[model samples]
Target: MPSLNKILLFLSSALATAISVLVLGFSMSIQWVETTMDCTSSGSSFSNGSAVVTLSLFDGTMTRIHCPFFGGQDDFEVFPQLAGIGGTPLVLHGLVVCVLVLCLLFSACSILISLYNSVSNPYETYMGPIGVYVCSSLSASFSVVVLLIFAVNVNNV
Candidate 1:
């Protein structure tokens, strides 16, 4: 017997949570780093070996290096780099993760509040929608900033 507004609110919050989870997962993936270099010879017109380096965050930071032509496969530790001057990307990543966590937490609270508001007495005061709006905006802004920082830093690298 919930109102249409309440139903929409619940659905929207759920959708936001799902989308945030997806974005966070994608962001944390190492696929973010992909580079190609040309080293062809003048007469042979052949392409040199190319390597793809990926950085992923799990129990610990990991870097995967793969070069099919050279038959080179190796993994390198990257945590030390985070302490160096080029650690801007890692710092930005941490910020993104923190913001996403906040977004998910607030959205979940919004969902629960909406459910309660729908089922409870009409006289009750509801603040869940406000929290949802604020959190959503904050999440969006932080996400954009993270993307920009990552893109610029990666390009520079």
Candidate 2:
């Protein structure tokens, strides 16, 4: 029978795998930033309704996030197209996604190592007790980075 330590490792690794999968799945639903800007007509009696735009994690299709700055444009009513998303904010979004993928890879490695350990004693110097800790730490560190990046992007960018 497998020792209690091995069983615990296997269970923890399984939980980590589940959490990793969830993190990746959540990334698919991108949140968009929204803004509305009112347009002014020089010859009209009143102001036209504001344009409502939801700009979120830009995939390079839109020039930039919709801001109130567009109200200054005299001919905004003529063209309905918004600017393509760009700049450092886009870079951070990509960074979050890449780090998450790395986290998932490390978590998978941890799961495999622990599962092997449950069957038989993994070599102490190579893939058992030490390996589990290393992989778990790496996965956890990457997770922290991903969270920090996402938080900063949402708050500052």
Candidate 3:
């Protein structure tokens, strides 16, 4: 049987990988939306209208739809200024994703190593547990930071 420590380490690593994947999915989705009012050019008889605007972080695009109760629908696309406004957040998010992938890979390796150690030399000491702890912690921290950045930046947008 594998040691209790090894079993715990494997579970922790698996949990970390699952959490990282979940956060990555959220970070890649459209994160913000806003509505605004617009007026028509009918002189004194101007009509009120509303527009729905959405910002997608992964695609770096702003989509707008003019949905007026009295007129035909109009769609507008504003090219995302990736380097202008979203540069910092995008870079941070990308870095977090890379770290998460690395952590997942490391965790898988650790699990394999643990299994090997258990079967081949059940009495010997191995570094798999230490690696699992380190990778899990690092990935969790990165995920939290990425979430905070997303929340703040999305709110601002």
* C-alpha lDDT of residue 126 in model 2: 31
Tens digits of per-residue lDDT, candidate 2, 98-135, equal 88778878878877777777666533323766787888
Ranking by lDDT: 2, 1, 3
Candidate 2 or 1, higher TM-score: 1
How would you encode candidate 3's per-residue C-alpha lDDT over 1-157 as one tens digit per residue?
A: 6577656655565565666656555665544445454555456456455444454544432233443434444443323343456656556545645655664565455555545554444456456567556655665575566567656655554
Query: TM-score order of candidates, best first?
Result: 1, 2, 3
- Assess the local accuracy of residue 124 in candidate 1 as a C-alpha lDDT between 0 and 100: 54
Top of the candidates by lDDT: 2
| Model 1 lDDT per residue over 1-157, tens place | 6666766665667566667757666666645565555445458667655545565542232322332334445565444555564556667656655665665565456556555665554445366567656656665666676667667756755
The per-candidate count of clashes, in order, stands at: 0, 9, 0
Error in Å for residue 102 of model 1? 4.2
Number of the predicted model whose TM-score against the real structure is largest: 1
Candidate 1 vs candidate 3, lDDT winner: 1
lDDT over C-alpha atoms for residue 132 of model 1? 59
